[model samples]
Target chain A: MRQLIVFTLAILVSTTFKVYSQEIRIVNYDQLDKLVSSTKDSVVVVNFWATTCKPCLEELPYFAEAGKVNKNEPVKFLFVSMDFTSKKEKAAEVFSKYNLPGKCVLLSENPNNWINKFNPQWGGDIPYTFLQDKKGNRTHYPKTFATSEELINLIKKELIKQ
Target chain B: MKHLLAILFLFIVSISIAQTTGYKPGDKAIDFSLKNIDGKNVSLKNYNDAKGYIVVFTCNHCPYAKAYESRIEELNQKYASKGYPVIAINPNDPVAYPEDSYENMQKNAAEKHFTFPYLLDETQNVAKTYGALKTPHVYILKKVNNELIVKYVGAIDDNTESAKDVKKKYAENALNELLQDKTVKEPETKAIGCGIKWKKN
Candidate 1:
């Protein structure tokens, strides 16, 4: 009976770990659009980043920190990875390494098809961030967030807006 | 006082916006004299026999640039003889990414067997002048009466994943139309790429 209980516990732990690591969903632009636009009561913070982008990697911790700081707020953080579908495993590793809060998805579509849909003015630069308030007002940041404070302040400002 | 502050804010915003705006299609591209990997300075004016140029702003570090590397080589192979030789430039600040340094760029070009002139935009002036925001960004220019007229600006194709699966060859289409002396249908396109690492302000 003791052996069986220990075996069961080990299997449960392994499965849980596997699930946690595999949590990143591979999504196309339509599904991503649904995820971003469906939240009516929360401000959606979407960060487009890639594992290969140096500045993007540097700024990941800031987003992670901001997500934790704003956990109770009506804010949803979505990390939309712009990595190739083949590099999903690498992206997943980074996702788990950061232990990032909120949902993480790998956008598998070629960006040219949907870049204009997100923002016509965006010149397809990575580390780009999109913030959509509850009222559907959108803000686009085409550069890196230098610090967690900067990211958190942006979220706070959006939360209090009408 | 509030009215004065508001006007000042508007003025600052306008200045910043103007600074960010870069060359559009049909604008005359400025020629640059940047150092080539061969230790010689190359400029658009030196290629007098060329009909146009496929100026690519790429780097050694970005995966997006790596993915398009072979395709860029192929573009030179196909078009160099047709008078549109590829002039690849490394515009990223080496301080941010060591792989983009001049020495590494030279090594990368040699290792990859790059046939085209791979130049270094040391001060990043050429990149800023052209308004290149990211690596693998292309500016296809056509020489018109000794002036480099920007014809098409954008990605190499519609697909970044696999060249075989590409549906629209954006750059190729523009090149074909230009070669035939016809107007380019798509003047501008946008693709996700690594942002050019600018020098610290």
Candidate 2:
């Protein structure tokens, strides 16, 4: 009887470990919609990045740090990786390697139309950023990564307006 | 009648000078000695036996270029034997992205077994001269009557990812046109690639 119980316990532990280790699939547009809707009271910071883009890689840590610092606040950070489908698995490896945080997701959509759907102001550039307030008022900053101070000031200004 | 003839002559001279801003169709491309991955000079004039050149602006790290690496190699293999060889140039500032560093360029070349010379544009002068905006951008030139004239300038194809989905092959068609002495059907097209990471001011 004790052997049976031990086996069962081991099975449960291994199952839970497997579940936790599974890579999260964030390609669903529905998930993104839900995130935006639920975080309506807070500001949403969306950063478009890719595993191969060096500027995107450099700026991601700043967003991660920003999320941690604002853990007690109402800011919702999303790191949308723009890596191609062919590189999806590779991107996952890179994400784990970097120990990325703050809701990492791989963008899944027809890439040709993605830029227009996201923001017309965006020039289809990597490391692009979009900020949305609780009211759904959106502002797109279509460029490379921002310095910590630049990021902080932008957030502070948004918070002040709120 | 004499005054009208002089005016016509002056207008022709003005048009000729305006057309010489850089290389155009039917212009002999001036050769330049540029450093390659091995720190050795590679010049267009080196291929004395070649009929023309295919100058492509590409780099080691851009996703678009990475996607088209094999296809570009295929082009070099197919055409180099036919006389028009590919001469690739890396125009991105190495300071902005270390992977674009000359060291990484050599590494990428060896690892990928690149068939053509991958030259570095030290000052981005060549890129500026050609108005190349993105990686994998192509400029096909041919020597017609001893003048290096631009045959075509654009993306390799309409689809950067795959030929299966390609609606058109710009470079291939241009080469075919050049071979037949016919005007390229599509002379220019936009390319999608990583933006050249210029050093921040």
Candidate 3:
């Protein structure tokens, strides 16, 4: 009886871990747009990154650290992986490796259709960051963050505006 | 006074953001003389019989560029005879990415069997003037009355991951339309790609 109970517990743990690791959602452009624009009473930090981009890999940890530091604040982090839909598993693996504090989604659609919708000024560069305050004022940073402090500071500034 | 200063700062930021300073469709593109992998300077004027050029700002390192390498080669094969030869330019700073160095570019082209002239934008001035911000950025120019008119600007296609999955061949469609003497319906497009590495001042 005890052996069966132990086996059941192990299965539960493994299944939960599997589910958590595969939690990276694959979203189309419209779904991503809704997710970003529909956030209520919170500052949204949407980071565009790819597994193949070197600078993106280098700076992801900073965003993850920033997310942890601002856990108490009303800021939400959304990692938008620009990886090909075929490489969704690799993207999920990278996302899990960071132990990121918020949701990670693979944006599976032609960027040509929606890049201007996010920011016409953005020339489709990865490591791009889009920040929105509670009132919907948006800021675009088309470069990598040097540290978690830089990200946290930006979030703080946005929070105070509300 | 603080509020006034803030407003002034915002205005400056907006101005910087809005400054595009790049070529748009119908704009006449300037010809450039850049060093090709063959150690010879290649100028658009050299191609007297050509109808136009497919100026691709690509590099050795970017995966998005690599993914479309074969397609770019195919474009050169399919259109070079028809007069629109692909002129690939590596625009990244080698100091930031050693993989984008001229030596590696030669190796990449050799390995990929690229028929196009892979040039190095050594000063990066050409890329800046054309307003190319990312690797794999493309500007299709049409020769009209001795001037190179910018016809299309953007990605090679709608899909970057799989060539077989591509539904809209953006660059090829523009080329076809140009060949048929029709106005390109979609003049511009955008795609997520590796940002071109610029030299630090």
Best prediction by TM-score = 1
lDDT of 3 at A55: 88
Count of clashing residue pairs in every prediction = 0, 2, 0
- Predictions' DockQ, in order: 0.72, 0.13, 0.76
List the global CA lDDT of all models. 0.90, 0.74, 0.90
* Candidate 1: stretches off by over 4 Å: A1-21, B1-18
The candidate, 1 or 2, that scores higher on TM-score is 1
- Pick by DockQ: which candidate is best? 3
User: Model 2 segments beyond 4 Å from truth?
Assistant: A1-41, A96-101, A108-110, A116-125, B1-55, B62-64, B78-85, B95-99, B103-115, B128-134, B137-195
Candidate 2 per-residue lDDT, tens place, A1-162, comes to: 999999999999999987556454657555665666577778888877778788788877777677666778778877777676677677777777665545667766544334445554333446778788878777777666567667756766676665
Error of 3 at A157 (Å): 1.1
lDDT of 1 by residue, B60-160 (tens): 99988998999999999999999999999999999999999999998999999999999999899888888899999999999999889999998999888
Q: Is the docking of candidate 3 incorrect, acceptable, medium or high quality?
A: medium
lDDT of 3 by residue, A39-76 (tens): 97999999999888988998989888888888899999
lDDT of 2 at B67: 82
Writing each residue's lDDT as its tens digit, candidate 1 over A86-124 gives 888898888778868777899987677788887888889
* Per-residue lDDT value at A74 in model 3: 92
Residue lDDT tens for model 2, B1-201: 999999999999976654433444444455667899888999887898888888988898798788888888889999998888999999999988788889999999999999999999988767756656568778898876666777776678766556577767789888878778788877655444676676555
